[model samples]
Target: MAKVKHESRWYPLESGESVLDGLLRQGVSVPHSCRAGACQSCLMKAVGGAVPQAAQVGLKETLVAQGYFLACTCRPPEGTELEVAGAEALRVPARISSLSFLAPDVLRVRLVTDAPFDYRAGQYVSLVREDGLARSYSLASLPREDALELHVRVIPGGAMSGWLAAEAPLDQRVFLQGPAGSCFYVAGRPDQPLLLAGTGTGLAPLYGIVRDALEAGHTGPIWLFHGARTPAGLYLRDELRQLADRHPQLRYRPGVLAGGTRDIAEGPLDALIRAECPKPVGWRAWLCGDPQLVLSLRKKLFLAGLSLKDLHADSFLPSTPQVGASPAAAGAR
Candidate 1:
């Protein structure tokens, strides 16, 4: 079993135990959520031993070179030593700039930071409250936008979302960590057909990605689909429609599983998408939203001739917090 050294103390891991579990078993106060290694809240560093390559997956090369690894996924070799990273090193302070409702249950949050924060659109950041509660939200604003925008779907008992929607004061300072994820738009394929699909606030990243592509002067045919159970679940319809109208290369399709209207299609969203693009051989697709839906669409797109290399996905998992309820659960992948 590997031994984890943290703050001058050593903890022994049981057979097949992860570094996070080993420390938590010994009553260590490590911040973590979405134990599946998606949230990246339990990030740590290996100072005296080699970290497992799997634990470094999805992390930036700079962080990996600096010895950072996800504790939740770390299961080092026998006799390996590690260290817990300080929270201060991983968080940057930002202040809330504005808030508004985009839908009945979705809140649009804008934040600004004096710190030099650089991020690509469609990436995600973890918002950490004063009390140590953290939840990941994706960026809906472009990099050049004046403020960072996040579309938060308020869950009934979500601690982070509820606080942001009801209690958080404007100008309240909060810590922001990470701008991870590779779902952002990449320029250079100006003429490649693009397909983007998302559900709920999953549209947040897709929204940013669409604008980013257009800003980069992409002349490709871009098809964007946003799905919801009802029309109320869909927001920004007019704004997206106006955008599509201004850009002849763009098309916006909004649909509902029920309550079909003259403007909105009614059917299984995945089926609707597949019917529209029966042969996606030369298409570059970006899928975001519920894990199950993203998984389904990924498989379908792959089977329909879309290359896996051209398909990017960011799947948000519902957070099952041990401390407090979080909206949309954990990791806005």
Candidate 2:
């Protein structure tokens, strides 16, 4: 049997077992941003063993040929050995390091682990509840933070949020996997105006991006616009405003998108953007939140004069983290 070893987290169980299998056997937690191949967060490279093809994971062709595998999918070929190398590539084994109510319904929790790793801002982590239900959460800290911060809006009956609110608390350990997904801030982006767009808790990663950009010494104009159904749903409005306080070049714009059709025209955030910068063809766009909102804004931005390449977005696909589905249901085009 093939032997699979993960370097980031300590492993137990016998060799040749699946990565998850080994993880569960040892009671060692790993973060997974996605169980399905659609999110690259669970990706692991096989240094030695042969792994079956997970054709749906969206891994680049070159990576697959080079023996990269998904811990959720591949198992080793007989007599082979594999290792999921690097704390950066693997998820930090952590518990709910801290939890606090950000709003009546929003909880900000941090997960701390005993490892060092790196990921671009805007990535996510998957928390596997006690009952094995998994939900993805965006990270809110810059790359160097020892603890990962997540902002979770407690859905009335969200399976995972329920666990967090009721049963889980400080120091309560759980299973998780992450540093997953390919959509995040691209370092080395040209210095230019940075457009930050978010809705709901999607602000998590955008916060991380802003922190990283400032630290990286980006002197370009930064614009942050958050559209909320109501002001209450905007979790960190004051925080963003506070950030703008110190950076004279940084601007924060908040709006209520659900007010009224007439209100939307009157508000005219997109139009205001065009008026300020007649041609924003080269500015970078970062958007996160409801897929519909992201889609609409993307279309509007492109129409207003932004190139598709200049736009980077993370569109949430509401899902239950179900175990299996037919080929068509797997989110492949």
Candidate 3:
């Protein structure tokens, strides 16, 4: 049997048991989500003993070099020692500045951090509650902005979204971790044609990226496509339209699967995009939204001539609605 040590405590791991399971079975509280390791909420650092390569799969090279591994996936050898990475060091304290409904199910949250929170537009952060419940949301505001903006979809029975929509008060303090993901605008690519697409609240990061590109004085044409199942799901229509009106180089297209108006494209989003840009060679693209949809579009766009290196994507899992549940456990969007 392998044994794991954390702080001053020792926990015995059952044969073939993972570090997370061993600690949890011994009544140790460790934050975790998506036990399968997708959420990265169960991140822990190995202080002693070699971490299994499998436990660090999908982690960034920097994190892996620093001995960080997903506790849920770490089945270390006998006598392994681990530590919960200092959560406070990674947390950026912020207070809710404002919240409003963008659509019936989407809440736009503005957070003002106590300290300068440096992050590129389109990166994501995990919002941690007082009880240690955390869920990841992308940044929809630029770094220069006074507040960080997040567009959260209020899923039925979603714990974090429900709190933000109904109970969280203005000035409520929350901690943020990360500014991770790699889908932001790069300033040097001023002349590269850009394609931005997403669905539902996935518009949040795309919105920020568009603004960032424009702010950087991008001279290339930017095509933005937003889709929803219905018109009601399409928030920020006027705002996006206004943005397009000001910038001749920017074109905004709104699509819907149902309830399409004369101004809105009526068809599948992927098909609409394919029809518009049949060959996206030499284009830079950013995609966000449902994992399946994003993955499918990525493949299609690559086959259509977009380079894999130039394509960036972020897939939002559905929100988990259970109180105190890990985002991965409930499916966090």
Worst 10 residues of 3 by lDDT: 319-328
Taking the tens digit of each residue's C-alpha lDDT, what string does model 3 give over 1-333? 677778777678887889877777777776655566655666777776777899998777877888888887888775554444434456789999999999999899999999999899998887888777777788899999999999998875677788888899999999887767788998887989999999988899999999999999998999999999999999999999999999999999999998889999999999999998888999999999888899999999999999999999898865433344454346355
Residue 29 lDDT in candidate 2: 50
Residue 78 of model 3: what lDDT? Answer: 59
lDDT of each: 0.85, 0.65, 0.84
Model 2's lDDT to the true fold? Answer: 0.65
Q: For residues 1-333, what per-residue lDDT tens digits would candidate 1 score against the true structure?
A: 678888889889987788887887887777676677777766677777788899999898998988888888988777776665545587889999999999998899999988778999999888887766778889999989889999998876677787888999999998888988888888988999999999999899999999999999999899999999999988999999999999999989998999989999999889889878789898999999888999999999999999999999888876655433334443332
TM-score on alpha carbons, each prediction: 0.93, 0.71, 0.90
lDDT string for model 2 (1-333, tens) is 455566554344364465655554565454343444544545566665456665225555666676666665555456655566523333445777888887677788887766664567778766655544456777888778877888887766555676677668688876555566555656685478888888777788889988778778788888877666666666676788788898877887776645634323224445545555566678888888777778887888888788998898787655423234232222100
Look at candidate 2 and tell me the lDDT of residue 186.
63
Q: How many residue pairs collide in each prediction?
A: 3, 9, 3
lDDT preference between candidates 2 and 3, better one: 3
Runs of candidate 2 with Cα error greater than 4 angstroms are: 1-37, 40-57, 60-91, 187-190, 258-278, 321-333
Clashing pairs in 1: 318-329, 319-329, 319-330
Model 3, residue 226: displacement in angstroms?
0.9
| Candidate rank order under lDDT | 1, 3, 2
Query: Of the candidates shown, which would achieve the greatest lDDT relative to the real structure?
Result: 1
- TM-score: which is higher, 1 or 3? 1
